[model samples]
Target: MSKFKKKTGTSQDIPTSALPDIIFMLLFFFMVTTVLRETDLLVEQKIPAATQLQKLEKKSLVSYLYIGKPKNAALYGTEPRIQANDAIISVDDIFRWVTEEKDKLSEIERDQITISLKVDQEVKMGPITDVQMELREANARKVLYASIKKVDL
Candidate 1:
């Protein structure tokens, strides 16, 4: 009875090192379960939102722009839509590119295609508007800005 009583009272079965492991595991589990915010762009800008907005249907023509610490022009163009938010392309270059592409296409084809610019939310009106003017000069019927979702020409 004494042996059994002593065995019950002084239990040496449990490992002392396991306490930290269990605590660490629990902490890790909670930390892993916590949600983290994601980064969508280089610079954070508070863009004005609409009350009721329609989602963009065509991802094909979608372009992206990032406003970083130093450079403001960061464009990403892909197939069917050239993404050029990286190095800033001036109005002259824009005009040249559009005109060159326009010269290749027929009048009918021109009507089918439209140029859309995705600018950083913080990017000023000067450049954005300049691109718009350039597009118009190049004879691009419909010019657009990505963040705005509408042309501000």
Candidate 2:
């Protein structure tokens, strides 16, 4: 009724100036904290403990061989199996596998390649011996046995 009019509507806007900053911060956080898994273990590994252990200097020059019982016993059976990379392979496959792995490296670094055997504690020496024989045949002389540090009680 007077010179001034009555205001009834209010603003409903949300502040989004910090939205991009929040999103970028979240992205950076995940990039820093996330760890990518290299391989999926098909077999159960319970490494044996050793008193005298030496750490490998260059992991890139090492090829890993996992020997243990299959986690899916019903499918792969209860016997100890050999795993190279991701697939389960046989004893005879060791020679071919070693050759292929060595071929992937430079000629100079070929001799420096180390074969690391990660065998389960319960597995018998028969499989280990077979693997060693195959490695010898392949001329991959440098071998390293993977083991945990023995903790004295």
Candidate 3:
């Protein structure tokens, strides 16, 4: 027999025990990088209770606006409407800003713009209603209230 042993690669090659580390690392990386949901700006707002609130069949078309009370201001995204503390942003603009990813939506999906209010519970009714009134003038399809849902761990 030749001095050289069989040189073919074995079927039992490198084991896959190392793969889980790579997958776990990738998973952790994505989890850390993921964006968390934003909390409402108004800390004082006692989110109204919903005895039976149905989750919107779809995501919000509603632009985020906070009724920053005492000095009632229209707060949206990270920008606050200073000039009109009680500023009523146009529904047309609301549509654009809230639905910036519109081409992803079908035509019927384009038209429905909902307004979500995060008014402080202690705040007077006038501004709250005024906000709703403006949205109605903008021909908003729905004006929804943002309430805190209680959950049990």
Candidate 4:
């Protein structure tokens, strides 16, 4: 009878010298590419879901308009309000706000600027209509309705 023995080799550990560099590169990539929300939402936004949704072409040329009830209804009332940047303003203020927003861009870029309206689904059409009229007066014609993608069940 003959006995055979199998050879065993020592395990080699992976080189971790480049690990920190890889991790730092990934972190920097995310930091640079991620678009952090510039303004916090003071009002509750329940964006309606839609089947047909398109991505906004240019983020730099886009300004957001939030319309919904204030997060703290006790302090700001339950009525729907317009939120431009960080401030909650009346519908009448939309013109000035749009003007200021448009002015931020150069003359060549002005035509490409889009005003994205984030309106709550539960809200009435009156406020939306008023905002549209104000936007027209402000000469900010490019408008977009921001909504979530509706999932098909």
Candidate 5:
């Protein structure tokens, strides 16, 4: 009855124009930040703590050798085994493995290659001594023992 009319309806839909941009930004962020694991450990290793620890400078020059009891006890038994690269290998295979690894590098970088031993705290010295002897025969003298830094009580 009055000159002004009532406006009862309003736009209720949310604007989705920026939704795709936000999604793509999040995808890119995760892709850049996530670090993929390089090696899948077959052996169970609990690295022993060391009083004196020195960090390796170049990770590129280092190749890891894992020594511990097999995770699959039913198949591999409960005895300690050696793991190089991805597969579990015997002590006799050490020389061949080391040679092949050195062959992958250039002549200038061959001598700089370091063998990192990641031995479990529960392991005995016999297997380690055999591995060391094989390494000596292979002439891969650069050796590093990987261990956690001990915290003082």
Candidate 6:
């Protein structure tokens, strides 16, 4: 053998100069693709668990209606309330709200709009029924009841 030693198969150190860039790209991708919770839940609306659940294919066609008791009894009182967006709304307001929401979309897409009901499990059916009637009057027939998927331990 000559003075030079034989080379052994060994892994070379990976160049980490672009590691930060790769990490930044991954971070940016997750930030862009993550589905942020659309609504700030002001009420105590713990959705009831269910066996079967279906995901809304198109998020744009969905409008959320929150029905539950106010978080602070001192401020909003102890009674249950219907929240359309940021404010607590009366039952009659549903019709106008639905109409306005529908108008935002194209006329052809109006019929495809789904009113998602996020009602509290602890609340009674009276308020829910009232909301349903209001939706019916508003002609927003596609109503979806939002619920948590039940997991059997």
Separately for all candidates shown, the number of backbone clashes (residues 3 or more apart, or on different chains) is 7, 0, 0, 0, 0, 0
Which residue ranges in model 2 land beyond 4 Å of their true spot? 1-35
> Tens digit of lDDT per residue, candidate 6, span 100-123?
999999998999999999999999
**Model 1 TM-score, all chains together:** 0.42
- Return the TM-score for each candidate structure: 0.42, 0.79, 0.53, 0.81, 0.81, 0.80
Residue 110 error for model 1, in Å?
1.6
**Two-way TM-score contest, 4 vs 6, winner:** 4
Per-residue accuracy of model 1 over 29-96 as CA lDDT, tens digit each: 99999976432343334444334445566543333333222322344232111224334344567767
> lDDT of candidate 6?
0.92
Q: For candidate 2, what's the RMSD?
A: 4.8
Where does the lowest 10-residue lDDT sum fall in candidate 6?
36-45
| Cα lDDT of model 5 by residue, 56-122, tens digit | 8888888889999999999889999999988999999999999998999999999998999999999
Tens-place lDDT digits, model 3, residues 1-153: 889898787587788899999999999999999987664343344566665676876664545566543233344443222112134454334434444433445677656755567765666676566556655655555768777776645
Leading candidate by lDDT:
2
Better of 2 and 6 by TM-score: 6
Worst 10 residues of 1 by lDDT: 76-85
Q: Rank the candidates by TM-score, best first.
A: 5, 4, 6, 2, 3, 1
**Judged by TM-score relative to the true structure, which candidate is superior, 4 or 5?**
5
Model 1, position 52: C-alpha lDDT score: 49
Candidates in order have lDDT scores of: 0.51, 0.94, 0.56, 0.91, 0.93, 0.92
Ranking by lDDT: 2, 5, 6, 4, 3, 1
Tally clashes: model 2.
Answer: 0
TM-score of 4: 0.81
Candidate 2 lDDT score relative to the true structure: 0.94
Every model's Cα RMSD, please? 11.1, 4.8, 7.9, 4.5, 3.2, 3.4
In model 4, the number of clashes is 0
CA shift of 135, model 1, Å:
1.2
